[model samples]
Target: MTLVEGAGPRTGAPPEPLRRNREFLLLWSGASMSFLATRVTAVAYPLIVLWHTGSPLAMSVVSTAALLPLLLVQLPAGALVDRWDRRRLMLGCEAGRVLAVGSVALALAAGRVDVAHLAAVAFLESALAVFYRLAERGAVRNLVHPAHLPAALAQNEARGRAAGLLGQPGGVLLHSAARWLPFGFGVLGYLVSLVTLLFVRKDFQAERTAPARPGRLTGEVAEGMRWLWRQRFLRAALGYVAGTNVLFQMLALALILRIKEAGLPSATLAVVVGIGGVGGLGGALAGGRLQRLMSQRTLLIGGAVAWTLLIGAMALTARPVLLGALYAGTGFVGAVFNVAAAVYQVRITPDAFQGRVAATAGLIGSGTNALGSFAGGLLLTAWGALPTVRAIAAAMAVLALLAAVAPGLRGETAATPRTAEPVDPVEPTEKPVEPTEKPVEPTEKGEGDR
Candidate 1:
């Protein structure tokens, strides 16, 4: 376990769980606000472009600009997160987003908005977000006790999922109300996040061993990649997620095609897709409890199997109601799987590696999303929707079965249980507790012997 220096000793009762923890509540609220803003702007950006240019190409360019940073910035940003003070990094990112979005609103108000300006704003804001997300993921490891990790991460997942579910429509509503309203509201959300950050007194980063050399940033990134490459379970999990992401992309395209084939309204397709968000929210809320009840293996493997079944069911029916139900079911499994995977990763990884690990994982998953979308377009055009859906579902089922039986998941062991830092009740100082139990190392049975 890692600990900050200058912590003398425990004084009184243990620190309360996150629900009652002052710092945690503030952080959670701030993060939620930021998420809502980001989500709103995600929809608003394209709408702004559409309003100005009335060209589908303009909308695509602006939208693609936001996603570019995920592919390009995550690995380098993760290394920077490890080197920088996380609290300051988050503050800077939020402040930058506020400025970026506020600028767009101001431009719109002045009737000076253009495609180039929107693209620049989108790229810059998203680049900052890459750093902010990595920093936040690392900070949570230091913010609360090990027991609270599951719940904290679960809540975090719910925040993102909730934003995804509601942000777009909310943005459209606000845009309809006024062109500048969505970005204006987004500015307020970031302002709230900044204020919350200002109030947080605790340090959000682990003590660094050495100052990061700008010259060695490349070496640092390579080191992070190597560390991730050595972890057997995470390596397998990344591959699984990457494959599923590709399939999910196909499912999304298939849904649109299916709706058109059935002579359903476009609004019906939106409702069906939107229902999946509720499933995600439900799963995230239940994640901590499910973790406490089930072994990591059970939750992950069961989620995989469930995902296969739910997505496969889509092959048998095109009824809108059944399709929505199937989508929701898959979303639930995805949430549970994500929570379980995050908990495992956080617990097993040392504090220093959190940023890079998160970056690597995120990069791979996100990179595949682009590929998946491209592949879905091709497959849908070539094979049509029904055959494409069934083929992908069958392939996913085979992969899930293989992952379930893999050695990394056998025996249902907790992945490298981390020692929770005992809180100093009087001072509110958090330090990592030393591990008393001899948990299995990552390379047990020569599994990670690469």
Candidate 2:
């Protein structure tokens, strides 16, 4: 893989910032709207499961089915992403999801939808989302200068949080109005995304040497896993996220049950949950600046600390407003952590390996989340809501503390530093270079700045 070089002499005037980059604008706007719609489905899916099956267990099962792709499909999908054109892969995934989710909408219109149907559609949509995300991650490096990676990723994070801030409540309210409404809009969003993707001018991925036929897939997957395993800091961060996701998923299930038992309307529960999204939105808007001030390590560990305190507080409160406040605090911290992590990952990973590395991290992180959903369902079934939430909150707090002290994560700088003097741009070539056996290590010189 070629190392990204700094900018060289421009043919005319200097290259414009991504703000005026038409291709990047199209990519960003499309993805922003699509993510918003996806969030709608994310919230609506659970609500539909609960409304139809009226079982927390059923909701969890459907959620697990949706997440199961992260566990099973991520590696293969990542390998394919590295092989395929990222723009095409993203386009295809978006198109596939449109069809899959639209089918659900149609079934609802005909009044023929069921839990089994929901599970199948959810699985298909989520699997597509995983591929779509990996392709997007892989494509970002190609869409802008290396110097702009942090800002681009931070903006992307903000886009997602904005979607969450609006979509979660919007989904619930729409579902309350009509079950099919969210999915119908989801179709429209994808259509917009598809058109925008068609108009993007730049290449979204670099060329790669095709691996020899037979055992390539397994080798590629193993390569990604090995790369991640060797990155001590990233691996530890993965563990931290995975652990927190488990408890958070459990907490979500418990919160739903608590609202139900309290006899609150679905809209009330939606508002409480949606309040967290506001914090997320605020955090995303600030993440670029925050990373400039704090080291990546600081952000990682500090986020852990914030989560521990916030979740612990959650255990002490049954009031919806108080719980909402705690959730918002956690979201704010989580958004910052996400931006830092994404920037670091993008900076450190080579273009050729981007898809695999992203997929590997996501596979492990999301696999844990899926397990959490399943365990949450069973735990809530056996122990009920309040006790289950308390126990899990305590566990998550202890784990966060452990992560803060973990050797891999404790000593790294908060943000990667950007280079000062510009260097020549590396030209794209078809010739294959020798693949390095050594894992890519973080440099003492930071590659991220405000």
Candidate 3:
């Protein structure tokens, strides 16, 4: 537990989790801060739009604009990441996002913000966010031992979910006090996130092997997609995850509206969501062990079925209390499902391939999410909320059955060798260190400019 300047006392136990994994800790802190702020943005984005425009579709456009950047930027950005210094890339991205979002906040405060400005800001921040996240995730293996990887990822998930729990509620509370409060809070969090990144020693950076010579950009991108495409287990897991996002999202969102329709108190809805958080914490913590016991394919397929059934049950139930109980149960399963997919994806993917492969997955995944949200809104508008929910449940059902039993997915475990599991999947008893140095060098001051 070596002291990291201004980082406060090490809250962790005496054993170093990633060997002298000080950089990983710093990176975690950086990512966690940014993610926490994003949660506030997540809340403020919709509420602010609603207050100004009085349209849910306007809010949906904001989400769509943010996501559209991924499809256009990810593959090219991934290729660029393979060529660039991942650390500098992340630094530039963080600094860029801070200004981008901060400028938007400033404009909003000045009463000059509009839909176009909001959309542009969302697009810019999301573009940087895509590359920054890819680099940061791509850097993980260089920072830690294979054994600590699983625990590290679990802790990351915990941070994200924890942020979601705290940030959303806090953002709402602040916005209730004042519309601009959340944006200000969001800016502060992003700044703190950027600042905390400075303490990490650069010598412990994630390393990349030299890229293949003479390969065309398009060819290299294809190679990565092909590698992942050939992996039955990974693709199958991706299928379930992709389907879950595409199919069940509307149902998930509709839960709140349903409670309102049934005359349930919004406070009771908060209690239900809080209960889901508890379940999520447990699931995230247990993710690795579960993966070890059951393959990702099994877990994903099972999780999908469980969530669909619970959602359908909620849709059928007349009582708000039972529906609320169902929400808690489904959230627990959903969290674990996410952990399973992410762990497997991270594990099977080679370190050199992380940036591109992850970007491809993220692009498709995010696009599907945007599409689902749009479709959900339109369907709910046309068919009414309850029937739209039933339609989503039907989609989830079809997705579950079609995806789980598909020929490509059914036997993925057969191809996976026990001894061949990537070192990233297993937890180590000791902190693992890189072979290049004895101890890490000192931290450097962050450059103020991009």
Candidate 4:
């Protein structure tokens, strides 16, 4: 077990089973609903634009608009969250998204919608969602006991994958009924999430006090970056994650093209994508066991290797069944990697640095993926999908190697109080009641995210 200095009772005993906590249950329920809404919005924006303009350029613009917020707002939003009460920040964000998306739903239902209007709403809604997610991530540690952190994070990730599966296709189906239906569904989900938050009673209490003299927000963010970068392990891990994400997007692009190239029907493609949700579910369930048995660094390397092999195999075989098999494996690896990374970060980060550190890493990571896709799009236009996919697969193999053999990065492990000082997690642990019990659960630890 990782030894923490001044361990608090809240951090010592195996965290109470997450599901047993009423406040956590309410929060989880709300998160699930909001995640589902995001998925629906993802599908609705593109489909609605395509239907209206029949202009591929118009569709592309909507995608660009939706993604801009993450690249621009994450660090500032994270800093702001740190300066305010996390729950209120989350609630306000949810309320804002609800109104932004609700306006679109009303406009569409009233026969007054247009592509420009839909894209503008999408931008505002996505921006609100970015801040909301940052606050939620920052507040998570306050909800569950320290020992239960892995399971709680795993469950959250599972809901995210579940939302993607249950919501996106469902959105498309509803859109068939009426283009406006999906937006209405998203608005309703946000409102439900807001109501759930209203009923939940939990506090995200931080012990850190801001400086008497205010520090520059940019300077604080830079401090987070400097600390992360100085730690060789963190730098390599971040690089590997960002590279893996780009490769994963490329693989996704390749699989779609390969399926179509093989003359598979749309239903077959849908089924393949839907089946990935099962793999995500399995990965989430397996995270607890994996953390105990595998080093965080090893988990990341192995997951990256697994994904690379699966994508490479798909590139070689273009058969629909082969593609599905590879996709399921890729999804499984991706989920496990995300779970391990997130928990690991929670274990390492000082509570004071949580919001800024998490957001800086998140924003940069997201930007890398976006940049990768943009590059891939250019590659596709110049050389087409197959070559670009093969190159992407090869690049992943190199990144996986970097994660495994990178020097100065081998010591990455769960945080020990010796390393992450000043900001303590959980209240201090009481003196041991009995020697026979370990107090801390060995099977559950290290939940990090990508």
Candidate 5:
């Protein structure tokens, strides 16, 4: 009944396929519903605000509120996830999101949708989502056999891309029908996720031999930061991912600007972005196979180089179709990189630190997105679209070169060995501690991740 961390499939035995894993299915289904709903509402927020207020500044304010959680709530939410029961935490998040989103629907139905109320709901829903995601990231390792982790995470990556592909279009269509429809759908999605979690039977973390003593919130957050800082490969990988994320955000804005400058129809922009999403989804589907064939270092370096070429290609084209094709290539490479990075981070982190570590990485990777958007606007205003894109491509080239020469990436292998070490709550130590209890065969009661 007791499953050990990092336990692989038995020798000479094929690993159990994920299709037959009930726990994983439930977890994946729930998380997928929630993620899709989040994206739908993400689009709906700006659309509804614009439709009602007709103020770009108001729309921007609401959108910014939605993203603020990634910066403000991640660390504390992560610390809380590690401290609380992960499954229960996720349940609470779902419940809170249901109410937050439903309130928006109710307000819209009653014709009382104020900008402040909308912004508050946006911030609350986003903050709860942060908690749910961190807990879900930790829960994933416990749900599947170690050998299946790559496939599991790959599927998760695919889920996210698919959501991105569908959610915006769906939101637009639903909003055209009724302003409250998207929020109503979001409420339903969270409800389904909540119901599914209630049925999951497996523990979300390894059984602790002793109860952990609660520490100061700041101290607990610091523990995760310190632990992550000690991992050379992860630190380097995070840095690389963060830098690329900022550039990609910039590139996204530039693409829109280019389309506008060229007087392309709005549908052209949709086609370009949709094609890019398809590419990301395809890459995610292939990520598990690709991970088996390439080392983490190769994927990182190759992806960076590929992105440089793709972005540089975009700078040469004002044609919508050509730009879409190049953007698709970048999306493919980015998806593969994300899968590899997520698998590596999850495999090596101890269950206890999973939330904080995952949160910290999320913060590092996505924290600068607003900056990138702001910079993209400034650069476009100052130098124009093609020139701005050329600058982004040049910056990406620098990142590619860094990936190639970074000392931390030099020793990375195709498969990272399990290096998780137990942390003593009262007196934390840097060294690994051997478990006194032997690991037993895993049971089918409950297991899976998001």
Candidate 6:
């Protein structure tokens, strides 16, 4: 659907800002609660498995279960999201997550913790999260005016970083106090998210003339993949993003190894990573302004260069503080790059294709994360932390060079897609309007009053 301004009455007043947009706030806050709860449980899973079973293998299994959905569920989930009612899908996901996580809490309270049960919960929770996230991504552009899309997504990025900053530590602290505390908090968070979602009144997807015809699931997934593959710039940019994602995964492991090799306390590792989270949060907060100032090409290439430099700097320092500083720089660049790319993708993709396209891109970009972590382990085992980090840095340099010369990237722009369907005008309301034609241009208020 087209991104249009809210049509207000002939008062010539400015449109309602995001803070006052009741529907957007409900969606955002509800999503934030769900995401934070997921993060907290992410940390607790391994901790609970290892503490009870005393089996690193069991912990690995649980962790792998959590990650497996990224590979197996994303494509199908995307297709399903496009076919189903997005708000209903999200509500179901939240409900599923609550029951899954709550079961774990209840089991723990009963002094029963089984590896198989934990793995099932982790897998189910992660899979549900995939559906929720895909639906949310498609819903955001529909809820806010086009002019505020970048800002809204920036806020989303910041929320994710902040969750990362607090979730792990919060999980650890909560688990220390009680085995079931983390999951209990997760239950509460999901309940709150569920309640908020119930209050959201806007439609999650653009209005369709008719229901989409049912098709083979694989065919639907392929349709999305083909559509994304046709976008030349997005195709090439996703390649760059995938490469960096792999390297960043390696870098994360390298940092932990470096701290251990330096005989530093575990607390040092936490501090270093936490500092990186702060950097990401800062970058996310600034992303909207950065998008306004820089073109997509500039942001992507510049971010690659910045990451390369930071990785190189990280290789030279064994000091905890120095490593933290360098890692933070990479986080900052990565966050800015993510915000720019997400805004561009959301703007260019059609409302109908949003879920599939986003899922396709996510699958390509993050599918190798596990491989990177595994490779990092092997590299650290064979070459040690410093050598492995130096190698990663050199590889990042190659990606940076590729970004500079990539033809698709060179031709990228910030303009709206020419082929997007026009949105029908509606009367304006005090709340944000539905999107309309000319996705970037601001129009009169009262455009969304159905």
Index of the highest-lDDT prediction: 5
Model 3 residue 149 CA deviation (Å) reads 1.6
Q: Model 2, range 1-450, lDDT digits (tens) per residue?
A: 122323322332343575766877889899887898888998889898889878999898888788788788999888788777789888898899889999999988887758888999889888888888899877776776554666678889989888877887789898999999999989988889989999999888765544424558998777767766766677777777788778878878888877776777776676667788778877876776576567776676677677767877766766778878888888888888788788777765556667788888887777777688899999889988777877876787687678767887763422222232222113222222222332232222323422
**Backbone-clash count (model 3):** 3
Q: For residues 65-161, what per-residue lDDT tens digits would candidate 5 score against the true structure? A: 9999999999999888888899999999999999999999999998876999999999999999999999998898788766577778899999999
Q: After superposition, how far is residue 378 of candidate 2 from its true place, in Å?
A: 6.6
1 or 4, greater by TM-score: 1
Tens-place lDDT per residue, model 1, 1-450, is 111111111342343546666777788889889889888988999998898789999999999999999999999998888778899899999999999999998998887878898999999988987898888877776776555677788889999999888898999999999888999989999899989988877778666655567787888788778777666667777887888888888889988998888788898887788887888888988876676567666665677678778877887887877888889998887887788778777766667778888999999999899899999999989998888888888878787787778875463324444344422111111222344554332212111111
When summed lDDT is taken over every stretch of 10 residues in candidate 2, the lowest stretch is 421-430
Tens digits of lDDT, candidate 3, 1-450: 111111111232233444346777888887888888777876777777878899889988887787677789999777667557787788788788788788877877787648777878788888887888788777765565443545566667777788888989887898788776777776787777677677766532334445444557786677678777777656766766676787656765676677777787778677767777767877776664554456655666677678767877776874645665777677777766666566556555655566777888887787788777777777766776678777776777777787766887664432111111133311111212123222221122111000
lDDT per residue (tens digit) for residues 112-172 in model 4? 7577887888888888888778777766777766655666777878888888888888999
Enumerate clash totals for all models, in the order shown.
Answer: 0, 10, 3, 16, 4, 16
- Per-residue accuracy of model 6 over 305-423 as CA lDDT, tens digit each: 78778888887777877788888888888888788788888877767777888998888866778778888889999999899888998898788788888888775634453222334
TM-score for model 2?
Answer: 0.79
lDDT of each: 0.77, 0.74, 0.66, 0.72, 0.82, 0.81
How does each model score on TM-score? Answer: 0.90, 0.79, 0.78, 0.87, 0.91, 0.90
Q: What TM-score, to 2 decimals, does candidate 6 have?
A: 0.90
Candidate 5's TM-score: 0.91
Instruction: Put the candidates in TM-score order, highest first.
Output: 5, 6, 1, 4, 2, 3
Among all windows of ten consecutive residues in candidate 3, which has the lowest summed lDDT?
441-450
What ranges in model 6 sit over 4 Å off?
1-13, 417-450
| Runs off by more than 4 Å, candidate 5 | 1-14, 413-450
**Which is the winner by lDDT between candidate 1 and candidate 3?**
1
